[model samples]
Target: MDYKCTLDNADSFLNQLKLHRDRKEKVAVLSDLGGWERAEGMIREIVHKAGADYLVLDNGSALDIAKIVAVNGVFKTDCSC
Candidate 1:
């Protein structure tokens, strides 16, 4: 299942991660913000800790991100607005 979450709502995102932990689902974090390297890195660490295979698309366009996610068959988790 695809999860739409914001970095501001970290609890909800963690909950979602927990729910999928057993399934060993792949997680993809997409962000268009150019100045949030620290925030992005934090989320990446969280995803790593969750033991989920992840892909990060930093400062990418919608179409490019979509294509990559589709090809990867990963669960898209938006962590940025």
Candidate 2:
């Protein structure tokens, strides 16, 4: 189901600075994934650029930083990777 994420109802608050998560070792790229398979492409880009591991979970899922990673990579991650 399509979801509308706003500041009030966000899984994790994206600070006014738009700091959704710690940009130091993790990066959350909020975007549209036509499908989980399709979204992996974006995940890889994030991983490559951020030089950090990633996770992809349902946007509506809880804010469990421990469970975020790419969803489409061959790494067999739950997100998309």
Candidate 3:
């Protein structure tokens, strides 16, 4: 289902999503809050640059920040010479 989230609650919502017990319970971001518009835009741009198919958070199953790190190549594997 979809949920309306604000900056105050965004972290909580994503954290709950990560901690969700039911695998079938689908939670998606319903709408972007005015207070978080700029942050959302930045996130959307980053997701877009990461080759996301769409800008909506609902397009994905989770909204955790870890997803961003994965997309932004922060977890790259390196080989030592």
Candidate 4:
């Protein structure tokens, strides 16, 4: 899904991605990472540590969409998405 998120806050954005993943929805974050390189790294790290799946895209990259597959024992699903 095309999700719009800002780099002003890393924690909040990561939480949103987790919420989507909990619902078995693959996330493709859309943003301009040209100058927000620091935020980009933080967000990637956060998603990686969560053991969730995600794809970060700027604008020109070719899209490779995939369904969010369920992991055996990832984060518990308590999100109200």
Best by TM-score: 4
Ranking by lDDT: 1, 4, 3, 2
lDDT of each: 0.32, 0.27, 0.28, 0.31
lDDT of 3 at 59: 38
Give the winner by TM-score: 3 or 4.
4
Distance from true position, residue 57, model 2, in Å?
A: 18
Provide the lowest-lDDT 10-residue window in model 3.
72-81
RMSD of 4: 13.1
Candidate 3: segments with Cα more than 4 A from true spot:
1-11, 33-81
Give me the candidate number with maximum lDDT.
1
Clash pairs (backbone) in predicted model 3? none
- Give the better candidate number (1 or 4) by TM-score: 4
Q: Write the per-residue lDDT of candidate 4 for residues 1-81, one digit (tens) a residue.
A: 843322323123445554554565544333333321111111222223244444443323321112221122122222211
lDDT of 1 at 27: 45
- The CA lDDT at 52 in model 2 is 33
Candidate 2 Cα errors over 4 Å, as ranges:
1-17, 20-23, 28-31, 37-81
TM-score of each: 0.28, 0.18, 0.24, 0.29
Give each model's clash number.
Answer: 0, 14, 0, 0
Candidate 2 C-alpha lDDT tens digits along 1-81: 943323322232223212322332233333334432222111111121243333333343222222322211112122322
Clashing residue pairs, backbone N/CA/C < 3 A, model 1? none
